[model samples]
Target: MILITGAAGYIGSITSYHFLKNNYKVIGIDNISTGNARALEVLNKFDNFKFYEGNFGNLELLEQIVTNNKIDFVVHFAANTSVFESTQNPLKYHDNNVSNMINLLKICEKYDINNFIFSSSAATYGEPKTNELITEDTPKNPINPYGLTKLIGEYILNDLSNAKKEFNFIALRYFNVAGASLIAPLGQFSKSSLLIKIAAECAANKRDKMYLYGNDYNTPDGTCVRDYIHVDDLAIAHIEALKYLKNQKTSQAFNVGYSKGTSVKEVIDIMKKISGNDFKVEMADRRTGDPSSLVASNKKITSLTDWKYSNDNLELICKSAYEWELKI
Candidate 1:
């Protein structure tokens, strides 16, 4: 059986559906601090799925679930993901992201869960030194506490793998993850700080106007650039990672992205075009620690696994998200 932490959240819910459709029994857990309970409504339709609405920090609870379900694989996605919020309250990030992982790892060790998949982030790379593609070997110089916490999580995994030769892990450092599940119509329901979600809200008239953080960066449109991958594609990457781990005895990390960059302005334009609503956009001062560009080089994952991105097109991503926003 597979155990998925943060299974009710944006990425986790869709991932749970993918696993269940592929005939894998899944045990899901979430604290509901930031997760949407409605996402679990979709997963509840599957008989192969079971859920616990609690935090992963509870060792006794995790132990009980792992023992009862005989969980052998763990896909950990629970995290405090706001970069700006992490700057304000760093201890929260450390406790939720780093300390929580430490506790989860302990449970994994105790339960002998040999296969693990970590939902890492591109924030671990921090600001890009050059405008080049960020490979897995890129220098990890995180500028924020949130990124630091994820980087520390990777370190803990690496150390544990070296000491316990039986434990194997795959850390997927994801780029900007956006869009809703086109199949299930389960979109991002959390109060997100992401640009695409914000733009979608503005287009839906939930907000009167949207603020562009910075427009003076050194890029084609003088705005920050990021690689936006559809959430379904990311779900596929997780399945591939799990299969790759089952076949190999080594632990590794791979970048999950589209190998292309999309600027903030470009995303706004696409959302506006798709929604056919020209919402008011205002330019604001540059946010501290914002990078000019951060794109991924996904060669490592493609070469090692059968994972090929099927939905890399930006228009379809924006359209799917916009449609979901309208529904919700």
Candidate 2:
């Protein structure tokens, strides 16, 4: 059986559906903290999908699952991802992202279960030295605590591999993972008011417009530029990476995003057009740890897994998110 951590999370939940549709016997684990129980409701319907509602930091619980289920492949999407929040409460991110990963890796060592697929972030790239797309070989100079933790996680995985842990793994450094689970009526069901969610709410009258964090950046649009990839495309990348690792390939990291980025103004304008509600978008000061631009050199993942991004454009991604928000 294949195990997925944080299976009820936006990315995890969608990847779970993808694996199920592909006929993989899937088992999921989550504490249901930031994850959505509503999304889990749909996953629970599948016979192959079993869930253990708990944290991976619980060593004994993870050990039991590894021992009992004979988990062959593990897709880890259970990291603390909020940049602003991580800065406010750094310890929480360290504990969940770093400590939990160590615990899970220990279990993998004991059980001799090695294949792993990790959900990483573009934050690891930090404020890029240049506007060039980030490749796997780029120097990692993380600027925030969250990004530092991600870099540390990658190091830990590399260390384990160096010690001949016999584990095969891949870390997909995601840009902005935006979209819903396309398999279901509701796709991405996040608890927090993320950018897309906030925009959708503003359009739907659930909220009064939205906040454009900063505008006087160095970019042409004078706003942050970020590469947003669809969740299903990311899920497919994970599956391909899993398949490649099963062939006994070495552990590696790849930038998982389109080689392009969209400005903040672009996103807001698109939301306004789609929702037909011009936002009284107030231009506010820059939020903490946010860089002006970050896009991926998606070459590694594309070459490694014969996979291509289905929708890299911002309009389609925003539209999908808006559509999903309307339903859920």
Candidate 3:
């Protein structure tokens, strides 16, 4: 059985569905703090899906779960993930992202759950020193508490792997993850500060206008550039990570992205074109801890694993997100 933490969140829920469709029994745990109940309702439709509404950090609850189920692999996606919010309440980020991760690691070690797939972020790289694409070899110098906590979690994993050769993990440092699931009616259900989500909200008339944070960056369009990956593509990466672990490959980190950069203005323009909405876009000051440009060098993951991109188009991604936004 596969254990999925934060399975009620956007990427987690979709990933759970993929695993369930593959005929794998899935055990999901969530705190519902920022998770969506609608996601749980959808997952519950699957006969092989068993869910518990609680924090993964709860050692007693975790013990109950591990003792009951024979968990083979763990896909961890639970954490506080806002760069802006991380800056505001650093303690919260450290406690939830760092402390809770440590607690979960302890449970994994005790339960002999050797294979782990971590939901890392590009934020761990902080601001890139150049405009070049980031690779797994890039220096990790996080600028925010959220990034630092994730970095710390990676370090802990590395340490654990070193101490116990039987323990292995793959950390996928995700870029901007967007889009909704194509197979189901599922999508991001929580309120978000992500550019695409906000733009979709405006396109769906859920919001009055969308804010363009930081338009004076050192990019071609003077806006922050991000490599947006479809959520299903990311979910596929997790499956590939599991395959790598099953093959007993060496533990390592891989960058997950399209290796193409899209500026904030470009994304807004695409959303406007796809949704046919002349949405109001107000220019705003740069948010804290946002990089000017962050594109990925996906050569490592593609060359090493059978991971292939299915939805790499920006227009299709925006349209999928807009369609889901209209439904929600």
Q: Give the Å shift of residue 281 in candidate 3.
A: 1.0
Q: Indicate the TM-score of model 2.
A: 0.97
lDDT of 1 by residue, 166-278 (tens): 99999999999999997775889988998988998898898999989988889998999999999999999999999999998689899999999999999999999999999
RMSD of each: 0.8, 1.3, 0.8
With a 3 Å backbone cut-off (N, CA, C), the pairs that clash in candidate 1 are: none
Candidate 3 lDDT, 70-133, residue by residue in tens: 9999999999999999999999999999888899999999989999999999999998897788
**lDDT top scorer:** 3
Q: How accurate locally is residue 11 in candidate 2, as Cα lDDT from 0 to 100?
A: 85
Q: What is the lDDT of residue 248 in candidate 1?
A: 81
| Clash count, one per candidate | 0, 3, 0
User: lDDT per model, in order?
Assistant: 0.91, 0.84, 0.93
Q: Which ten residues in a row have the lowest lDDT in candidate 3?
A: 243-252
**Candidate 2's residue-wise lDDT over 1-328, tens digit each?**
7999999988888888888988999989999887889888988888889999899779989978977797999899988888988888999999999998999988888888888888888888889889888888888888788998998988888888888657778888988888665556447666454677678767767766578888899899899998888888888888888888987578989888889888888888898898788867887788998988998898877787777767766777778887877787
Deviation from truth (RMSD, Å), model 2? 1.3
TM-scores vs. true structure, each candidate: 0.98, 0.97, 0.99
Model 1 TM-score?
Answer: 0.98
Candidates in descending lDDT order: 3, 1, 2
